[model samples]
Target: MDALDGRLIRLLAEEPRIGVLECSRRLQVARGTVQARLDRLQAKGVISGFGPEVDPAAIGYPVTAFATLEISQGQGADVRAHLARVPEVLELHTITGIGDMLVRIVARSNADLQRVIDRVVGFDGIVRSSTAIVLENPVPYRILPLVDQAAAE
Candidate 1:
């Protein structure tokens, strides 16, 4: 992508709902140009779907924990599939570390957290799991940094 594509992506990443007309107005380009660029970006998979960012606390899950799991007897895919079916398991990653997988989970209460841990450990392939509850969160979630901006500067 060129500088113009970078600018368009940066603007859209900040405000996905901004219409083509408004983007064109801001960038001083024609509306059709903005629309065409956006369409091309989408077609190329550079710009994916735009959706809401919800707060877990507001939805009744005030607790957050990071879980480290060790799979037993090479239960990889099965463990991943089981975790995928669970609602509280927000994000799971296969990382290069001592643990087999790392999971981010949210729960309503301490008991709820225990239940989550129990359920996770109950999976056939999982041998052991450890959890660390987050006491405070300063920075939550945000979009990726605009790499295009940095390259230009």
Candidate 2:
């Protein structure tokens, strides 16, 4: 959570496949130092995984929607498991506002979205669901700004 750590994170984020040796060369630090920092960062859970980031739209699924689900009483676990089985379900979060759970889903088309929605709400534990299709994403998901702000501090 220092400048070095932030820089290391940004470096990796920009070049996920970059090796530790190259990182050391670019950062002007020893290879061992880069490795140690990376190890420490991983151990601290600051860096979760090195998996590739896939875009839903690029893979034929361009339609994006968010569904807010109201599940049956005490059916959170069951609902969660049911939702987990659905491949289109991208992210799920429990909320305290108007809905019990919020979910991000993707589909090949608007009509396909209905099928996905049906699957999402098929479980008996799910009471109701309200969906909103995404028109555009002016600002997509990003963390670099937060990283830079934290680094400056």
Candidate 3:
């Protein structure tokens, strides 16, 4: 990724609805150049998708929590499949730490969170689990700084 790519990405991140022609105009590049760069970025998996960002809170599920799960021996696949079946399980990660897997879950309220947690760890493959509720999200997910650093390189 070059400086132009970084600038283009920053512009896109700010205004996701902007078109290629407008991006080219703002970046002072040809429309085809902008289009080609975007295509290349997508093909290389740098630009994953152009879909609208959806907030779980806006959709009625406001509470957020993380679950650390320790599964029974050789039951990783089964545990993963089981967790994937739950709608509230937003993200899952296999980690090298106190737990075998980490899951990000959401719920409508604190009471609803217990039900979600029960369903999450109910599978026989799961041996033990721990959970922590998110008090606040001072820094949500972002990648712009990395993008700029890559552009600098």
Q: Pick the candidate with the highest lDDT.
A: 3
What overall lDDT goes with each candidate model? 0.86, 0.95, 0.97
lDDT of 1 by residue, 71-108 (tens): 97668989999999889999999987889899999999
By lDDT, the better pick of 1 and 3 is: 3
TM-scores of the candidates are 0.85, 0.97, 0.97
Backbone-clash count (model 2): 0
Regions of model 2 farther than 4 Å from truth: none
Q: Count the backbone clashes (under 3 Å) in each candidate.
A: 0, 0, 0
Best of the candidates, TM-score: 2
Error at 113, model 3, angstroms: 0.2
lDDT computed for candidate 2:
0.95
lDDT per residue for candidate 2 within 1-153, as digits (tens), equals 889889999999999999999999999999999999999989988889999999999999999999999998999999999999999999999998898999999999999999999999999999888999999999999988898898889
| Candidate 3 per-residue lDDT over residues 30-109, each given as its tens digit | 99999999999999999999899999999999999999999989999999999999999999999998999999999999
Judged by lDDT against the true structure, how good is candidate 3? 0.97
Q: Least lDDT summed over 10 consecutive residues: which range in candidate 2?
A: 143-152
